[model samples]
Each structure stands twice: as C-alpha cells, then as structure tokens.
Target: MARDEGGATDSPAAAYVFRVTVRIDPEVEGVWTEPDTFETTVVRAADSPGDPGWLYFRDNLWRGECGDEAHMRAVAEDALGMPVDAIDFRELRTTQAYLDDLRAAMADDLVEFNAETVDAALSKYLGSSIHVTDDI
Candidate 1:
C-alpha cells in the first residue's frame, strides 16, 4: 500500500513482495565480529498461478522446505549480494482478493501440484511463511 505525506496509508498494490531476511557473517577485517542481516524483497505481480512469470516461486520452493538449508541460504545471499548464514522467510504481503484468487487457482490445479488439496500444495512449497496483509 502507498502512503501519502500525511502519514495515512493508501490502497494496496497490485503485486506482492516476498520479504526474506538473512544473517551474514561480515568478512571485513577487525571492524566487526558479530553477524549482520539484510532483507530482500522480491516483488511479483498478483497474477493467476498459471502465469509463466510465477515459475520462479515454484522453482525455488523445495518440497521439503528445510531439507536443503544451504540451497535456501544461497537464494537469499544471491539477492542480498552477501554470504548468508541464516534465512527467515518473512512474509508475502498481499491483498485478500489476490490471496483468495491464488488459492482458488491452486485448488483448480491440484493435479499439477500432486496434492489432494490446495493447502497441501501450498504447504509443500511455502511451508508456514505465508502472511497475507493489506500493508503491502
């Protein structure tokens, strides 16, 4: 959502931002010893799940979300331009309508996801990282 100079929030955006925070061990010499973190916000249109542009989300989501920790960390590191030591899939900021539409689309394509239901498909891919909100 956009906010005017009056400090009031506006309507939600048409796309969603997947914000992921990562902790990195700084390589700088003698400047710091503790780890630092940065968040990367990846924006994607609130399009139908069938759209080709949504492939990146499907491609990066592992069946077992935490099975490949290194792979997940790499994704965050690539986006943040730093070697990430840890990752936290913050949230998917979106509107209620977009989320409902996505779930409906997923429900219709359960076969493609190899799951009996839409929720199962979502869990297989995103785990518990999804958080729908109008504050996008």
Candidate 2:
C-alpha cells in the first residue's frame, strides 16, 4: 500500500528529511583589502539515511593595481594546491567589496604595513609610490 504524505507517521521504516543551503565567499584577501576573491557553496540534506545532492558556486573579486588574471589564477592554484579551473574568477572586478575576510589580518598584532613597503608594491603598477594612509 502507498504511504500517506500527511503528518509524521510512526512507521519504523519512515525517515525524516531536511534541506540546507550555504553561501560562502572564500575571502582571498583581507576585508576591504585590495585584490580579494571568494567562493560559495550550497548543499542539501535528508535524514532518510540516503545521500543528498550537492551544489557549489564561486566568485573572485579584486581592486587596486588589478593583477593579471593569469597571475592571480596561478597564485590561487599554488596556495590551494588545486586545479586551476577550481579557481573561479567570474565575479572578479576592480572595486571595493564590503566583506570581513581581513579581520584576522587586521587584528593580528604581528602584521604591520609601513608606508614604504606599501608604496613599493603600489609603485610597481602605479608608477609612483603610495602610502597606506586609508583605514580600508
């Protein structure tokens, strides 16, 4: 006989089910930090003791001296030790993003960036020295 789809049944063979969704922006850089990237993931679950389907999404963003996409890809690959395709750069844009991925880096007491060091990196692309005077 077919089972009823109404209220929960006390049948021993029956099982509960559920679903889940997760959006992750794998912050590649510090929050409000230049040249940042991210990736998102979604998943579904069921308590019926059976496997559930999985979904994944990815996005990479960046700002300031927009590095070559190829170079960025290589950096990501080396850092993650994964395939190049896995690094999704679809959402990458030269703009500031409102994310808190850099909290650790900023809060860390050991991490320090002086004006000279910052200028050198910027000078490589900006053709001139720059200072990290901005709070962002």
Candidate 3:
C-alpha cells in the first residue's frame, strides 16, 4: 500500500452486514418441519472495483433495503446450507475512505447503473442506511 505525505494508506476498507430472517412456511410444508421466524447473519465480502457492486440498485433493490429477498435467501442458503425464506438488510458499516472509493467507482459508470449521479445510485440501493464507522 502506498502512502501519501501524511502517511495515510490509500487502500479502501469496509464491511457489510445483512441481517436475515427465515422460517419454513408452516402452511406450505406443514408443521412437521417448522421453525419460527428468526434472525441470522449472512456475510458478503465487499467485492473489488471491477465487480460493480452498485448494480444491486439498478437490478435488485426493491425499496432501499433489499429489493430481491429471494436472491438474498439464496445467498444465505449457500452460506449456511439451509433453506431461507426471508432476508433483511441492516446497514453497511464502512470507513469514509472506502465510501470515497465507491463514489469514484460509481462515477465512472453512471449510465450502466441508470443513475444520473453516483449519490443517486448509492441512495437508491443503500438508502439512509450507511453508517460511517471508525472501526474496521
């Protein structure tokens, strides 16, 4: 990692948390295999620049939290190896430097995201859910 005059490293760092709730539908599968709705965590490591992480807004996000719960459920199932019925987005805890990199990356491809600006793209997907944290 390269450092500037102030000795601040340029590498971007961030972390994301997705809170998931799931249960087998008692009506569909019968009560034989059933567990009440419960919360769990699904880990999706932040992808590199070329991955275009912002696409969730253009293609997935429904309101501002999670647009495609099914997709999230699939992700959790893959991670936990269990059937998941629901997924919820809590917040993206990140460092300011990481956000700057995200903004820069988004600015490079506005049309692909169907966003007039980077902030718009971020807001559409993340909403007011970003929490800038000092701790990585």
Best-matching candidate per TM-score: 3
Better of 2 and 3 by lDDT: 3
**Model 3 lDDT per residue over 16-47, tens place:** 56887766445564355535667787645455
Q: In model 3, how large is the Cα lDDT of residue 73?
A: 76
Model 2 lDDT tens row, 1-136? 2357785433322111111121233456654523333343211111121212110101112232223556654655564544343332222111122112122222332223222343332233333212222121
Query: In model 2, how large is the Cα lDDT of residue 19?
Result: 17
Q: How accurate locally is residue 128 in candidate 3, as Cα lDDT from 0 to 100?
A: 80
List, residue by residue over 88-132, the lDDT tens digit for candidate 1: 444445667767877887887788778898888877876766667
Please estimate how well model 1 matches the true structure, expressed as its whole-model Cα lDDT. 0.61
Of candidate 2, the 10-residue stretch with the lowest lDDT total is 51-60
Task: Tell how far residue 43 is off in model 2, in angstroms.
Answer: 25
lDDT, candidate 1, at 4: 91
After superposing candidate 3, which stretches have Cα over 4 Å from the reference?
Answer: 1-12, 22-37, 51-59
Quote model 3's TM-score.
0.70
